[model samples]
Target chain A: MLSIRNLTADVDGKAILNGLDLEVKPGEVHAIMGPNGSGKSTLAHVLAGRDGYSVSGGEVEFEGQSLLDLEPEERAARGIFLAFQYPVELPGVNNAHFLKEALNAQRRARGESELDSVAFLKLIKEKIAQVSMQPELIKRPVNAGFSGGEKKRNEILQMAVFEPKLAILDETDSGLDIDALRTVSDGVNAIRSPERAIVLVTHYQRLLDYIEPDVVHVLAGGRIVRTGDKALAKELESKGYGWLTGRDEAA
Target chain B: MTTGEQRATDLEKVLRRGQQQLAAGSAADNWLSAVRERGASDVMTMARPDRKQEAWRYTPTSFLDKAEYAPVVEGPFGAIQPADVEELMLGDQQGTCLVFVNGYYAPALSRLAPGQHMPQVAVLSGQLGDVPAQLKAHLDGIAEHHHVFAALNSALMSDGALLYVPRSASVQAPIEILHVSVGLDEPGICHPRHLIVLEEGAQAQVIERYCALGEAVYFTNALVEIILRPGSRLSHERLQEESALAQHLSDLHVRLDEGSRYKHVSATLGGAWSRTDLRLNFAGEGAQADLDGLMLARDKQLNDVHLDIQHTAPGCISRESFKGILDGRGKVVFDGRILVAQDAQQTDASLSNHNLMLSRSAEVDTKPQLEIYADDVKCSHGTTVGELDHNMLFYLRSRGIPSARARQMLCQGFAEEILDRIENPALHGRATRLLTERLMTYSE
Candidate 1:
């Protein structure tokens, strides 16, 4: 479903992702594990078409089409979603209003009729329950004065509503408590399907326990060093990334 | 005479053209006649404010120098339709209504509430049915003192709305005053005066609106004075929507006594050049004041807002916030000052002025000042001028919304805060619709 061939990118002229390569097929879930500053978030940004990232070398393709040539909104309309680790708070913009606009925009792009407020509200009510978020929060401004856990749950809610073809979660579990972690995991697990692919980028293997991945890849020095089955996650959790690399401490 | 002296004399000669005509001509023995005479003399000597003055530093005075103005002699309430006035009226609002056309009272269009003992509502030239004898004592008490515009408005003062709520009375319904200006053969001027007095423990809500009926060059100079006695509460909303060729100027002065509260919201949405000068004075202890303003300027329009707040007693609180959104080479100026007196200990005050520029040529000059003499007071003043947030733009785009639509949504949200501050639902909804329509048609 996706392919990255010797992809190299830089932020502010400093190389972050150097010669990174990866492949994922439909109906597969891949977990990428890396230590701090291992270019985990950089890979996610490159795929999502965020600005300020320069692609120095190589190419990325999705379904036989070059992904780097598309704009951020264009990629989003094509069913590519990126759940930001730190969702931006927009003051005075209602969450429900923003989500309805987003959903209708994607529908219009797909040559479908737009949903009115009554119909959109009915559909969003169901998704709101799936993510276990208070309906009142949806009426308030988008993530303004929201707690960290609520922000993560709101991201998951968007993922469920969007139903993207490829979902990329970047450090989404960093600021969640145990209860919030389980609720977020449940939300993610419920959205898993055979026709969709998801990429999980994290430093801990605890999330792997709730939503198990079909494959695990070790990322070090901005490249995928090793690829193995689910057992590889447990090995890395026990020995840490320092055990795989020869360094005394993990970056 | 020297050149400078000759020029000054010529300016004074021009300023006295309309000083002798009084719309509601009263007895010479009446106190109002003396005020008019004083105001006219003041205008003759005191020069019009220029850019060199600190208060008028950022606002241009070239527009005021274009043509000579004469008093608008109530031109026969010509071709004005009630439907037009109805369209501008607050939807389904139940209140006492007073309609004026070119500063003349329109009896057929005005409606008086059906209450025998409520507040007195009448035109300045009509009988004051239930008003107290002290009404004259409070007139011109706290205007933009010594300003040429205020003096000019006082010099040609005509019929206006007079509302006075007695002591301990609660006026449940709001008082609505609509000043409609229609075009004339040549450029004309109208001066509308208003006086609102809420006695001790009295409460009321008032809405004063200024609108234009045609696209012709005219001048509207209005004055509003409000006094809140001990333990009184008042909410005042002023909306100005004139034609693109019209120039509107207004001065608002509010005085709060012990344990009183006053809330004010002013919006300047139309006109070629618009200015609303506001002054608020906290006279007694434990008083609270709130001043909120919004301005939308487009198409070479210029909107200037100046606010001055004074805290004279201890344990007083005041908050002032003004916002502007300018597009299409529009210009806006905001100068806000808050002063805490020496004995006003434990006073709390905050002032904020925010501006958003939608075009590179759009101009916004904002200055927020705080002058504090009391050591135990808490005061803060801040000013911000910038474009839309990049993160907010990217977030909306990442959700598949177009860039233009995303910006529109953000701009609407930015302006929605002021509208939401209005407590009246009907007024809030109407302003929201108006603002939304403007935002839809506006583009950078």
Candidate 2:
């Protein structure tokens, strides 16, 4: 369960998200569609607790607890996962090692026993299979020289391993080919369960074809203008967001 | 210029304290008395190292603060390495094993590698070798060059180590010298001196290590003199890793004879305030000298490396390369030089120093100098200091890797280039462990 009550956020004092509100329950998939400047990516950053974003107004509650007060790492420890639109490339940091550290850090923060190298490796090997990633790729520096589609898929793989309670996908499909999109959606669908919720942020309806959303919200002018069903996504894909909102947008 | 202008600065206070401590002991108890008697009252007078001093320019001597210095210590340096520390602090190379504890040679903790041709390593902890017949001409001859520390080392060396290789003998194994400066409860001062001689056509490898243990605040005034006979080839490595609680001073004097090949590599990863002054000279034609150094400094650590290469003979080649990575409030200074004598024609030399600063607070100063009087000589020098590549960082972050983790990996990669130069597996592993620890602690 999650709630955003008139949430307002800004980067370097410039407002990016203004009075935006959205909610999702267990097992529900919600998609937010917006044009270039519709604050789509800003929502993902705010939910992930990225720094440099000042919350000038409003509040955000995740599972009945205020989320704005938590740190990015703290939110991560609490099972709030955001698939970064741009994953960082770590030169000498092995992918498997990085994942293991992240997993162990979260575990340590949550008062759980840390997994040794052997057990962690076995678990990641299985997750890599689910995401159709190779073991060697996991051994190399995290996403070093990785293709754009591979980076997007790796984000999903990490989400699978962490098993976050609320998964926020931020334009994860932008760089993916059709096949990659299908595989990524398949990976997302496999992790879908009644105890977790998924928030999908995208402008294209193509991802909706893989894992159809229960609700589709139209975001414009830094606010949520409309909330509709899956058919609404198909309607926007055909007519575009121009008829939906006659606002000035770069894209 | 005038004695009145030279007041007792802070560094002098510390040095005088050392002098008094040395004087209190009987001549029979100490070996450096003759040299201590020759102590310079005007440590400040001779200590005038202004920006005009080429080697002292990049590294502002003002950093030492003519005042804020502590006294040298006299006991076991406290636990610098953690209890669960990695096993390979020193590699498993075969040869005579020389160990130094708090600048004092610790003979109990060393074991020489079993080899028929390997040179015997002996501890001159108190008195050095009475000049040997074969190396007598070159011994101390190279030590008399220009370093004030070398002069002081020649005058006061309490205890040291000696490695002697007979003429025409080829040693395949490496000789290891390990120094552990205890910096805990009992602290005073430690002066470690090492003398290595390779006879004509002899071949050998030697490793010099300075590790600080515990929390002792002391002085490690170390001098290692290396002499290579004609046609001899020697491989040497020096490692300095101290905690952020002590002062380290090390000087190396290296000389190569005609047709001899000499290589010296130093990996400096940690210290509170440390300086490595390396002076190398080529005496004969066709001789070669290669010097390489690496430093990883974090926190408020200050690391300075100064190198002077002199080519006095024609047909000689000398190369120098150094790299430094600074983080936290750490500061690093590097100075390298190549000198070609007027008659030394056909001399080839190259010098380069590169630095990477990971933190805004971290600073680095690097200078590479080349002086050539022989028109037929070929010489070049370069120095570069900058931060990590932004494009490389962006490339890593684009792959879903967190920004923090990505930055860390890039730092490690930059260090790996230097660590890979080592051929010995054990040595590589030990240095890697130290390098990784430095990077991790600095990033946080």
Candidate 3:
């Protein structure tokens, strides 16, 4: 339900994403695998509508609407979620309070009834435990003292709460251990449904073992060079992307 | 002498009061008379502070024109009271609620509050008999010998809040004192003195609020002294929502005895020129003190606070933290020093002052000092001044919060330290609302 055409972006006057294009339909899982400098995180940040980046040339459409014309909050209201590679630490805003504010903002934008504090507290008790998160974590300032894994799990918990139509997971499994990886992958898989689409951005084929993707695209030199089914991931894991892309393994 | 001549000639209208009470006064009254005369003579001698003085290093007195100020002997607005402001004052004693028409106490317009533990207040002049002896003894004792304005306050002081707590007695609720100034006639002056004595094992909370009622050219010189006996606890809050054109100078001295505790918080929101000098003396073992202050200045305003915390006994602890947020060319200065004496070992002290300057023209200067004479003591201090972090702003915006709202939330977070100390949830909610209001006002 998302289409990216000729996405060319620049950060601090250096080109990062060059002529990147991709698409996914509802109920489909797309995995974009690339080398270190393959611009995986840039695509996620660009789609998330983060500032300080100049979108040189690109057309991003979500559900037949132009995404570039919308603000970040507007994008969130339209069911677009980006699980950040590194979560921010809001020192004074409580984690539960932050989530409640975001939820209410989206609900208000959509003319839906919003949940109050009592209802939100009841909502978190179950959702936090579903991801094995400690109940006290919600009471502390947002990500103030959270570990790397707890922060990622919190991102997933937010995804579950918002139930976004499209989720772009950016290196959500990079720093996780095998146990954390399984938990995160299971969390993502648990939310899989016919009406939702998943875009998994990663540097390895290890996470593909848990939540299999319908399509795997090989990205090199800031652009996608190859697209294939799930076996392509295993082939690349065994042979690497240098053979098919004909580029030096510089990054 | 020419300007002083004009000032004295002008105050002849106000200083003419108290000739009768002046005939029959206490020993402290005689001392106050001498102090006031010294203030009149030294109005020129009390030089505006420069950067050369150690205590005035971070604070420059370029804005204060000593020549423009004259000693005021009486309240200017004799019989006028503004309808815009409300005074919800309470005291622990029983007496007339001595009101002020301008800066002068109008004993006629004032009446006594209800019962015991309700404030007993009156003008120090006409009805001084009902007040306890301790009140009269120390009413003029809180002012430091060297403070020009404080000594001036003692001299021509119109009226003040005098309190005395017997041993082991605690005032249940907060005691609020409001000093309102009304009229635009001539540049006038007000000296409000307060003396709070907490006997052994007594506890109390006192809040002092000052607000200017009119466009009158005025100055407020105030002195408050708190004496906490052994095992006594006291909390004092000082708030200033004065008019933009007014000048304010305040000095507070607190002496805590063995095992006594004192907590003080000051919030300065408005004033063209506002300065506070505070000193906390821990003279007995196991005494503790915590001083938390927050100030928000905007629109070319100025706010300055200087504090000294001295540990004279062993096993004493003190924490001093003050923060400021400056916008629109406004300036702020916070200078705090903590002194640990030779015998004051096992002392734990920390002082920090942080500022957020929203504009390039807005300025904030902070100095945190520690002088430790004993070994094996824990002492630390730090000061930071900076603009907003763009990364944090961007992070908030990317999460669906608008850029303006993101800035507001981040600024509120910067101010959260002081807001967290508000004990009551309703009060906390009010502080949060004020922070957000400042954000919006800054935006406009």
Candidate 4:
């Protein structure tokens, strides 16, 4: 469902992702684990076509189309979703109104009928229940004054509502507690289907415990150096990334 | 003479002409004649506002010289139907509606509540011969005539709306004063003054709207005076949506008595050149005032708001917030000043002005001033002029909304910060719709 071949990207003329290559088929879940300063979050942002993250060289393909050439909104309409690590606060944009506009925009781009407010409310209520988010939160401004846990759940709720085919979870569990992690993981697991692909970009293996991944890849210095099953995460948690990156921790 | 003196002389001539036009239709009442004469003399002696003046530095009044504006006489009032102005009415207000067309009261278009439970309403022009003593006292003493436009409004004032709430009466419905300016053959001008008085312990809401019928080259000089008696509360909402070819100038004066409360929200969305001067005075102890404003200017339009708040009594509080959205070479100015007198101990006040520029050439000039003479007082002020947050923009676009729509939403959201303060849902909805419509016209 997604392919990245020697993806070379830079941020402000500083190379972050150098010659990184990855590929995934439909319905598979891949976990990319790394330490701080690794290009895990950069890779997710590059796929989502965020501005200022220039692709120096290489190609990223999604469903046989060049994803790097598309705008962020275009990528989103083509079923590419990136759940941000730090969700931005929109001070006066209603949470429900924003979600509805997003859903309708994507639907319109794909030649589908738009949902009215009543239908949208009903759909969003169901999604809110799926993510275990407080229904009242949707009435307030998007992410404004929201707790960290509530913001993470809001991201999950948006994911469930958008139902993107290729979803990249960018450190969605960073600020979440154990209970929130379980709720988020449950929300993610419920959206799992044979027609979708999920890529979990995380720093630690804590999130993988609740929703196990089929493949785990260790990213260091902008490239994936190790690939294994779920056991690789546990091994990394115990030994740390020093052995793989050839840098000793005590140094 | 220098150019400043030359312009001043020219403006004085214009004011004299307007005064003559008003005197030609003079009523028989000596008191009314004296008011007009006082206003005319006050404006005749004062020099025209120039760029060198502190209050008019950023705003240029040069456009007034280019047009010959004659006073609008008793009517050729346009043949307007109720349906033409149906959209301008607030949906929730079911009390009284006073409609004035081209500075003259249109009784056929107005509706007053049937029973005696409503506040006393009258037209100023009709009451010139037999003016009530209470009306005369309040009208003569409600506001000062120091402002140039306020004096101009007084000199040219022919008709207006008068509202009086008796003591201890809590008015449930809102009173709406709708002023519609219709395009005339000549470039005309009108001065519509409004006086609202709430007796002790009385509560009421007043909505004052100024709208244009078409693309008319006219000027609307308006003045509003509000007097809140001790323990009284008043909510005033002013909406100005004039024509693009029109010029609008307004003055608002509010006096709050002991323990009285005053809330004001103004939205300025139209007119090529518009300015509003608001002065609020806390006369008695423990009074509170909240002032909020939202303005939009684009395509060379200039919008200006000048506010002066005086805390003259102990234990008084005042808050002022104003926001502006400018695009397409538009210019906006916000000058807010607060004064806490020496005798006004334990005073609390804050003022803030924020502007969002959508175009490279758009400009905003904001000044927040605080003069505290009391030892025990809390006073703070802040101002910001910036463009849209790129981070917030990207966040919205990343959610599948297009770039243009995303920008529109962000601008509307910024405006909602002020519009949300309108507690009346119908008025809030109307303000939101007007802001949205204005934003849509802006170039993306």
Worst 10 residues of 3 chain A by lDDT: A242-251
By summed lDDT, the worst window of 10 consecutive residues in model 4 chain B runs over: B1-10
Candidate 2 lDDT over residue span A106-193, tens digit each: 7877889999989998999899999998668887777779999888888888999889889999998897899899988998998899
lDDT of 4 by residue, B185-257 (tens): 7667788988899999999998888888878878888998899999999999888989988999888889999
List the candidate numbers ranked by lDDT, top first.
4, 1, 3, 2
Instruction: Indicate the residue-level lDDT of B77 in model 3.
Output: 48
Model 1 CAPRI rating: medium
Candidate 4 lDDT over residue span A72-161, tens digit each: 899899898889999999988999999999999999988899999999989998999888899999999999999999999999999999
What tens-digit string does per-residue lDDT give for candidate 3 at B1-444?
244543322233223342333344444345356546655454435544567777667655543444244444453445443334433233242333445544555544454445645333434543444556666666655456355566556556645767676788866656555677664544566677777888889887766767666555567777788888899998776667677777787888889999999988777876788888898899889999988888887867888889888898999999988989888888898888899999999999999998988888888877788999999799999999988887676556555666677777777777776767654343355456655775687733
| TM-score, predicted candidate 2 vs. hidden true structure | 0.73
DockQ for candidate 1, please give it: 0.65
Better of 1 and 3 by DockQ: 1
lDDT of model 1, residue A110? 85
The segments of candidate 4 whose C-alpha lies over 4 angstroms from its true place after superposition are A249-251, B1-14, B24-30, B127-131
Better of 2 and 3 by DockQ: 3
Q: What share of the true interface contacts does candidate 1 keep?
A: 0.58
Maximum-TM-score candidate: 4
Is candidate 1 or 2 superior in DockQ? 1
